[model samples]
Target: MASALQYIEETIICAEILRLMPRFLALLLRALIKRCLRSHEAIYVTLLPVADQRCLERDTRNLGHDLPKHADCIQWIMESSSRKAPWSGKRVVHELMAIWFGSVHALTTTVTFAIHDLCLHPEYTEPLRAELEAQYIQFLKSGRGLPLLDSFIKDSSRLTLVESSILLSLSAK
Candidate 1:
């Protein structure tokens, strides 16, 4: 049997026609919108009937009315993708859902506990704040090339889990 990663690669490489069509339409719509925007025309355009056209319209209207031009450009780049090759829409959605769940839960729990710990350990507040400031200075000096800051942030994340059992386990022989 193929490994899980291999199976995933194969599935993405052979995505169905129905799965591929919407993504292609989305890309075309995005390109047309971009062209319209650059030509000083209205951002709204009639999109091909697809499930995601409403989403596209909402995003475009919000961009034209509310978001700054630079932000809208960034959003367009982030959201649009070309579908020249097969990619399983179902698999992409599943992966995104998993990441959203993991990040949201982990970040929320970590921040909650960090605040609680800081409140309980008031004596450490000045020192911790000083450390943060020192790191910020170092980041500024190095043009933000601060691996140590990243390490510290990651360590802080590990130390403040919602439950001890949520930590990863290591097996010893």
Candidate 2:
């Protein structure tokens, strides 16, 4: 269980790092280039056009197959683009990247902080651990049917979010 938690923490941190990489690179570019290269602008001008083309081609190829629906950003881009006056691939890519970064950061932060809170409040630890064990397989299969785990995560997230807001307020002074 300890190992599992450690693994999860490491995975979340790694994912968070990966999710921020574009912004980090853009910051580096802004620093080195001596100009304000916003991350989205940098990404749009550099790589997203190619990705958008690839995504469009793939979706076109899979039009008849029973594939999962497109991601929201990609779907919107496809809807907006046409034979003429096409949507900018950069915008599509930027929106997708933004969503990825935001979702990963929010989820990882919530989970990490909640785990920290669980550590501090040891009384809830055993019950939570037991609940996790019981629900682990089910969660793996259906990603649901874990009310206890959900409640624990929500409670932990709430407490940690409140604490973080307080800390942020203090530090801003």
Candidate 3:
């Protein structure tokens, strides 16, 4: 349902098809719009309370990076929306919903691809599991921990970051 909304936006850009195929476009648009509306309603119900909390925070201004409570992405979007023309409740809800839809799409795609890759190479699964079990926390910025997990995800992305570089260099020397 959420994904249909994304496709509908893309479909709207080519206006010729919309004009040429009224019945088909109308059916598609009607269905997607209905789904989007339902998604909006569900997210709005969840986000209204958070927006209220944001309004409460507006007066006190716990708006600093130093503040521990200011960690939520939905809160950040609400705070950063528009100072000149404050967004309506509906607009805010839509924004939050859009963010959630994007996040969920990314998560699902990555997980799907990862599962496929893991199945393609079964040998790394146990070592990767062991690496995760040994580490309680990972500091990805400094690369202080969880090298195996990092390499597992990003090694295919970049050739230089692989652990086998050391062995290759030793063989050459």
Cα lDDT listed for each candidate: 0.40, 0.55, 0.54
RMSD of each: 18.7, 10.8, 14.5
Residue pairs in collision within model 3: none
Model 2 ranges off by over 4 Å: 1-41, 48-86, 138-142, 159-173
lDDT of 3 by residue, 27-67 (tens): 57545544543434544666677776665565446455343
TM-score of 3: 0.40
* Comparison by lDDT, 1 against 2, better one: 2
The deviation in Å at residue 133 for candidate 2 is 3.2
lDDT tens per residue, model 2, 35-139: 322333444455566666756665665566554555655676556656445556665665555455445456767777778877888888888788888888988
Error of 3 at 19 (Å): 23
- For all predicted structures, in order, the TM-scores are 0.34, 0.46, 0.40
Among residues 3 or more apart in sequence or in different chains, the pairs in candidate 1 whose N, CA or C atoms overlap within 3 Å are none
The true-versus-predicted C-alpha distance at residue 33 of model 2, in Å, is 15
Displacement of the residue 143 alpha carbon in candidate 3, Å: 7.1
Q: Write the per-residue lDDT of candidate 1 for residues 84-121, one digit (tens) a residue.
A: 43223332333333343345455655665666666776
